[model samples]
Target: MSDIIAHTGSAFRLTLRRAGRSLLARIGCDCPLCGARVAGARLCAGCESDIAGSMADPAVPRCPRCALRLRHGHCAACLAGAPPFSRCVAAFDYEPPADILVHMLKSGLRLSMAPVLAGMMARACARQGLVLPAGAVLVPVPAGRASLRRRGMNPAAEIARALAGELDIPLARAVLARRRETPRQATLDRRARRRAAQGLYVCREPLAGRHAVLVDDVMTTGSTVRAAAQALIAGGAQDVTVLVAA
Candidate 1:
């Protein structure tokens, strides 16, 4: 009887401890990104300010098709001929701390950054006055099977899932698949990157009359996304848009 009483008391203490932690999390006194103590916020003030500053640079004019930095409103290349995607929206430039955050999320296995990045992307969309067609689906650029096996998760898919929840849209991961493995785009030049992305993705479901927004972690030359968008259009999507974290 004494042993039983002691066990019950320990269990009660553990339960109380768990409840306390839950309450603290709800209060959110610690920053999720930097782990600093904050006041009634998920991210600390410093981190918020840094993110805002990163997006305030005006020298990097935006390109409408790929959302990349360009000399003109839309790059001369994209203006010469548009890709399959209608528009592109990138939340931050791939520089400094923003690039570090993306690397951490991709290689460091920092899964918590997904929702934060998705929120930034949503804000970017709002700032650019981007609105999806009704019933549009969020399709993530599929990671290669080998990459998925090594990384244990797809960063693009993680971001897409979070963005879908934020926008109240359906996620369609099953519709697209990476049919062939390719070298990392970061390692290749523009010509090599284009060749590497060729025939990399395939669509399995009928996308006829369906609208889709492709989600990715970053866009460099935009070749990989263009390939994915082409696959979606070939599968019968009405149109596609590209959304990226940086």
Candidate 2:
């Protein structure tokens, strides 16, 4: 009885807060970083600018092919052992504000933020002079049933859906599928992550010679994206370009 009452009370308090915020938001109370005013929005231009400033520019010494660290804008690893993907594009460094955005997308279910993030990614691609296929297909990394159940939706797919709509490209959902339920890659080291991701993705459809852009909310160690790229390559994709929108 006590626990139930506590839960109910908590719910009531949260509802009141939300209602108050909604009312305030109508008057322009949005978060500073996102420029969305809500009832209790800590929306301040200064705050948002501070957060936005944390993102690294695409000019940093990163591998041109996969956006990984490069000694001088191009990594020897990529040169010596190039990835199957022809190119890669990302919006911001996967830190602080970027991580926050990804967290909101996954845990807070902030679908509305998709457009904002996607737009930033588009801008990044443009700035880097990234080559996009004329009729490219957006392929989201598939999530496992168990993960979907826990998160309520696939973060990558959600971002890709919004991105595809904005880019006017067709999203191919039937191409790749997650063949196993692997542990979260974030907790594992590079070797473990690679081992876990090995042989975990399978292409079930014909993608022979198709140019594809793989979409995801974040890219940490680049293992998951690589695994997906391998699968897409096996499926006959001529090229795979990864996009991390945040």
Best by TM-score: 1
lDDT of 1 by residue, 37-99 (tens): 765423576776676444546765666567667765559658766888999888878887667
lDDT of 2 by residue, 126-227 (tens): 767776767688999888787788878888887787666456567887678988888876679978987888878888887878888888887766777888
Give the alpha-carbon lDDT of every model: 0.80, 0.72
TM, every model: 0.81, 0.75
lDDT (C-alpha) at residue 154 in model 1: 94
What local lDDT does model 2 show for residue 146? 74
Report, for all candidates in order, the number of backbone clashes.
0, 10
Off by over 4 Å in 1: 1-46, 52-58, 72-76
Off by over 4 Å in 2: 1-59, 71-80
